[model samples]
Target: MSDSLFLGIDSGATTSKIAAVRDDGSVFPSELLQRPTGSEGGPEGVIRAWMRAIDEYMAEHGIKWSQIAGVGLAVPGPRRSYGVLDSGPNLPDSFNGWNVEQDLISALKQASGRMLPLALGNDGNMGGVAEAHHAIGDQRAGVVMLAPGSGLGGAYIDPTGMCLDGDHLAGMEVGHMAAPLHLLDVPALTCGCGRTWGCFEMYTALAGLPDLLNLALPRYPDHVLADPSLGKKERVLKLRGLAQDGDALALELFDLQAKAMGLLVGQLAMAVDPACFVIGGGLIDPDATTEAFRSRYLGGIESAALAYLWPTQRETLRIVPASLGEQSQAIGAAHVARLTVKAGSSVQPFSSTSR
Candidate 1:
């Protein structure tokens, strides 16, 4: 380990990612640890899993906490009230009252034997930062990140190429916005967060898309729609098979997903008018066949007379897939650690015991 290694952690629903970067901008896969977020066990279980992973990685790398610069974490939900995660309905009950930022800092202090400068922010904002620094290249300012995974997560990158982490770290909740559900009688889209009939998440999130597809095709008999046991990988593969076999239902479903995604991106473009939009997630198939996802997402941006929208005279929106693949959040967290370390002149001691 370098003398001043900065660590970044991207914690997602499935796996937790960690990366370390040296001062020279050279990055190494410090450790990639996979653990159940234990959302079922609640927030404390999630925190335990994370800490255990870090400890295991440290031991494996023969790295000590004192040699490390700082740690940055990319959390899933909006930071409510002093960096507490109150609205993460997916998180276990234990997380309801936990102050994530403060708790993590204390934990790291005990583990590292030094006060670690901690910076906690929304995962969406970190995704934006990753896009700006790694994907946008020369086009730094005015970038928006559309992380299309379980749902649509949004992040805005400013002129200096830094994502505004936002007050309480609630930068964007694009998935929670109202989306169209022409097929449903209720017309309201339901979200995983328990809100009904809104945003593309109702139809696009990994858990929600299959049900939406089934609902979209009410004409088909109820027994024909399979068990709906399809995961993201399986769903994408199914779409490819359907598209290959000329299945009209698959085509329609994919198109609907694209349009819903596009409209949401359009709304984001209207708000920020970014120079480029970076899209990322499991829905994006590697093969060129899924280019429609990119095109439809970009084509949805069709509004005029707004100064904030990019290209005042002409529509100049560039929608590109994310460059970092699945590691974007982890890398972004590493940058966060670097910044935190740079901001603080001295390292503080970590309290050995939990509060």
Candidate 2:
């Protein structure tokens, strides 16, 4: 342990990742811990699980409350205010309008007999923060990150390593941005966000794969993924295996996904003109597949994006995979906590009347 450490917790729909980061923003892989989020039990259960993980981690590592400078939590939904969520759609209904920061701090005080400063951040934004500081390391360059999973989430990290949340703290909802439906030759389909027309998320998210497959399956009835016996979950797994085996249909689906990604990146370039784009989330997980598929997918994205980018922009913009993988959000949260404590704002003792 260093003289002072920051604790970061990334609370996802299924898992909560906890990690300790040093002042220099270095996190040991061995110190990373993942626990079930206990979301079925709602907000309290989730908070309790995090507390237990923190308690277990500290006990195992011989860390004391005095050694922890602050804590940061990365959550999935939009923030209503600092330390609170407007709604946690991916989580249980109970998390809606929850003050996770205050509750977690209260739990820490009860369990550890001390109050620590804690900060809250959107998970997607936190991922970008981690990449901006730890992965890219160029303070002069802006970075935009797109995380394609069940839904598409995005974040913009400015040159100074701040995640831009805009005036209402609801900026960077890139997934809901209107997509070029013509590029995909798909009808204007409603997005999960309830948009009547196509959105970027409808074309690239895992949730949209089934719709894509349904549209394409008629042309390739014999496709392994078209088996009537296969359920949605199994079909995704089978598709990955097929992709690894170089199945044409699987490759085509991924290519279409890449094309949508490229268009989204190009559109973002015109708006943010980020120095680079970092692609992360479950969609890009290597999962034992050979690099060939990943390369092809990424290559397709770059090629398509270049067609849409300005000539001057084409030379400077780069697209890369997230280096930190699953740990990115946790590390970013820890970094945010460290920054919060250092700035001497949003650091406070637990007060029952604070809300």
Candidate 3:
């Protein structure tokens, strides 16, 4: 392990996750915590949860404030700058008004009794970079990570394997890009950002699953999933279980998700042309109830892309599952803290002295 350690915070709509990570992206699973976030109480709810998680993890791992170098935060929206969040649709009302850097700096120092340099970045950007760094490393000339939950998020890596956070509005807004008009045969589902129908995010995430289910239900009237008591969550669980067994309704819904997702993936292949695309979030996990189901699900995504790949070859951009699983974002944020601080002494240099 390196002499320095860093803290990474991933503040999501429903949960806030935290961990202590090394510069090399290594993390001890024992030194992690997850808690509900700033939904009801606003920013204070978020800060309290974040601090409590940090305190509990540091205590359990015997890590001290002096050994920590800096803190990195991953907020789930576009950053106005390094430390400011421009929009937070999923977050509580206070998040929209609070100054992330100033508020976090004051609260974090109060928690640890020392001032640590804070670094901030978009959640999608960090998640993509983390997956690229771990999944492809130096082997790939380029990679892009697409997260398809809550809302779509994307990150790109150059040939040298370093993730790129492009200047405001140019890159990373891939989610906001319009989906093909043909895909919107169902009722229009507007995004929280107030975008109209046909947005890439509307058909790809769990949020979009309800809309997909409504469309699929009409066609699968004879299927067992049509039971009204099943609800969205239960219906999803049952369908995935059945899909693993080649059930028609289950397979068709997944196929629909892939077909919609492939539109965006296909578009990315033309513009960014990454060697591989890592897909993450709750929708797809290669590890499943059965090996056959996992293969079928992944295969569904690949085969569906053929329709949209157009000028580019169908196999151009490979798709893969997230290697680091849920920990990828937090680990990425810590790496950002580690890298940024190492780049400049004036940066929030973590204490290197051994306890």
Q: Score each candidate by Cα lDDT.
A: 0.64, 0.80, 0.71
Candidate 1 lDDT by residue in tens digits, 307-354: 334455245666667777656777777776675555553433211122
Higher-lDDT candidate of 1 and 3: 3
lDDT of 1 at 281: 69
What's the best-to-worst order under lDDT?
2, 3, 1
In the range 1-355, model 3's lDDT, one tens digit per residue, is 3656889888888887887667555665563478776557767777777888888778888887878888888877655555555655565555664667767888888976887888777777767767887776647568878887666778886765445766553376777778776654556677766887657777776656666777788887877878887878877657667877788877776676677767777778778777787877655665654666655656766776667675556645578877777777777787677667766744333221110
Candidate 2 structure quality by residue, lDDT tens digits, 1-355: 4578888888888988887778766674455678999988878898889988887778878778888888888887666676677765566667777878778888977865777787777888987888777657745788999988888989998876778866676789989888898877887667877997788887888877877877878989888777799898788767766887888887778888889999999999999898889988655667745678778878888988999899988987889977777778988888878876766665553222353
Candidate 1 ranges beyond 4 A from true positions: 1-3, 12-15, 24-26, 36-48, 59-62, 180-198, 203-215, 218-241, 287-316, 340-355
Supply every candidate's count of residue pairs whose N, Cα or C atoms clash at under 3 angstroms: 14, 0, 1
Give the lowest summed-lDDT range of ten residues in model 1: 346-355
Provide the global lDDT of candidate 1 against the true structure. Answer: 0.64
lDDT of 1 at 12: 74
Error of 1 at 213 (Å): 2.9
